[model samples]
Target: MADTFAAALDDFTRRDWQTLAPDAVDDPVRVAVVGLGWFAREWALPGIDRSAYTEAAVVCGVDPEVTAAVAAERDLVGVAPDELRSGAVAEEYDAVYVATPNATHLEYVEAAAEQGKAVLCEKPVEATLDRAERLVSACDDAGVPLMVGYRMQTDPAVRRLKESVADGALGDVVHVHATMSQTMLGELGTDHDQWRLDPDLSGGCALMDIGVYPLNTTRFVLEADPVAVFGTTRSEHAAFAGVDEHASYRLTFADGVEAMCSVSQTAQHASRLEVTGTEGRAVLDPAFYEREDREFALERGGSRVGVEFEQVHQPAEEFAYFGHQLLAEEPFYPDGEHALGDARALDAVYESAETGSVVRLDG
Candidate 1:
């Protein structure tokens, strides 16, 4: 089964898959999507729809009409979100992709796990540490793989950065800095931006939305967990009443290395990651987004060298990797435990912000 799946995926890779529907391959991993929102519809579906190794067999969403329309457009079965929550739809697929809201991830993951389906959940795993831990436990108890959708982790440029750091090209990492911000709110109030301002749904503000990119990417590059965190947040605009408009946090790793990160919803569009070590420094500009051209640079010995990686389809790469792992029955990157680690760090960030003190993590 694995060999057949790999062969089909290889064939698809050789062709212009975006212009073609997913070929029906032998023993392809059937996937049920559990959200038809912006990311799910625009990014996730296209990836799965183009992959020969995975078949998007079903879709479920909050609105039946929207779900049905998407399913009809994609030529897949459509079901209500309630059917997925009830675990009735789990029998039709080998895995479920939970792209729902932050706070609703646990229930969907649990429902999929209960039916012994592999789960690909969106980042953070859950809004809170307790729920994140539970989500991991449920998947573990079900003996199924649980992967978090950290798309940047699969990007070629980001992977090269990870390799450089892991290979000790940058010796004795001392400090890391990352910033991700975007202008979400405008003079005219938008409904999409309003829901994100609600702490109950979004967990926090920009920290929960875009900040996790830096937080997770830093941990991935360093391969070290944070021991303590100090954070502060502010709501600069009256529109952001229930949640913060901007946040900055510093993480102290066990090796005495520190990472400073900032995230905002009312700032100019910027995303970058910089790592400085004893020997050299590495930088990735527009680090987290999917773009045709991305710049990565290395600085050493008073000289700077850089390279541009282009045509990176991160969503497709991520889903393809997940399908490969599922077929091989191997461990996947940024699994539930990995997401749990990030969730804990984020929890500490919130704690520190609220108390105005450094919060320590127990090893």
Candidate 2:
């Protein structure tokens, strides 16, 4: 049995994976990063700097002085959001990375599209489905590549899991269990006036913020969209009154795979994804958080085998993948259409929670 597991794992490693681009291009993709929030300041800018295929060329934000200061420190040009929206500095970068709030993605994306620059928009696409559709249409009409930042798709462990499931090493995946949670107020120093708590800004609460990880990652692993969802949500915290502080949703896929997922903003910080199949089960502990070390293991017939891989800076990996695909002139997966589906699924989950009934997608 151990030998059988080894062979299956060997097959998993043999599949082609995304890697550094060859020394083919002379220049890296110059990226203009909009939004100087914590993610952009901490992860996205540093990630772009680390990526061999990409570099940060400009910073744009609502506050011109703050944006310019950030750009000065990084030795990059800083421009007001208006300049980006109007394509005033379009010559400085080849692509744009939209890291702004959830509700304001379309304007930056459309601005980039009009300038014929590729866009890598952060997840959830936009705050609403109609806006998401318009965001996609903007890129579609411009005929430029639009990639959603589903960085897990580029993680080594996640890639291996996808391979295992796709190759039937899991023998018809039967069910999935996923959890992602974090103490939002604690993380923000007990600040209750943040945009995440506002439904208009964040689209929802815990479900929209962290729940998308499990939902989208499961869809990536199974290669199928959820056809239906049943959900329940709660908001006990005063800060979370406008949005859910806790949410649990069950997703039903077309292939009979059912995923039970839970997310929260006022819970302990942790993430886990588990998949069960007829032959064996695979688990990815610390799956969603990019900062932690990811551990992957497969168990069957009272035996378990662990797979090993080096942890990577996820944002860097994601940015490199986007740059490589852009330079190669290939279509990037998790494109606008993919994100739109997630937007729909997210809405369905919220609808189910409110209506106290299962919500059917695409109906």
The numbered model that scores best in TM-score is: 2
- List model 2 lDDT by residue over 29-122, tens digit each: 9999999888899899988987778999999998878897898899998999998899888999999999998999988999999999999999
lDDT of 1 by residue, 1-363 (tens): 222122212322232213323443467789999978877887888888666668799999988899989989988888987787787766678999998888889898888888889989988678788889999999999898999999888777777777667766677799999998888765223564555777887798788888899999999988888999999989967778878789999999988999999998888888899999888788988787764346787777677766633545778778877887777666887898889889988998989999999999865
For residue 23, what is the lDDT in candidate 1? Answer: 49
In model 1, the Cα lDDT at residue 275 comes to: 94
The collision pairs in model 2 are none
Q: Model 1, 177: alpha-carbon shift in Å? A: 0.8
lDDT of 2 at 238: 83
User: Deviation in angstroms for 27 in model 2?
Assistant: 0.6
lDDT of each: 0.81, 0.88
Error of 2 at 229 (Å): 0.6
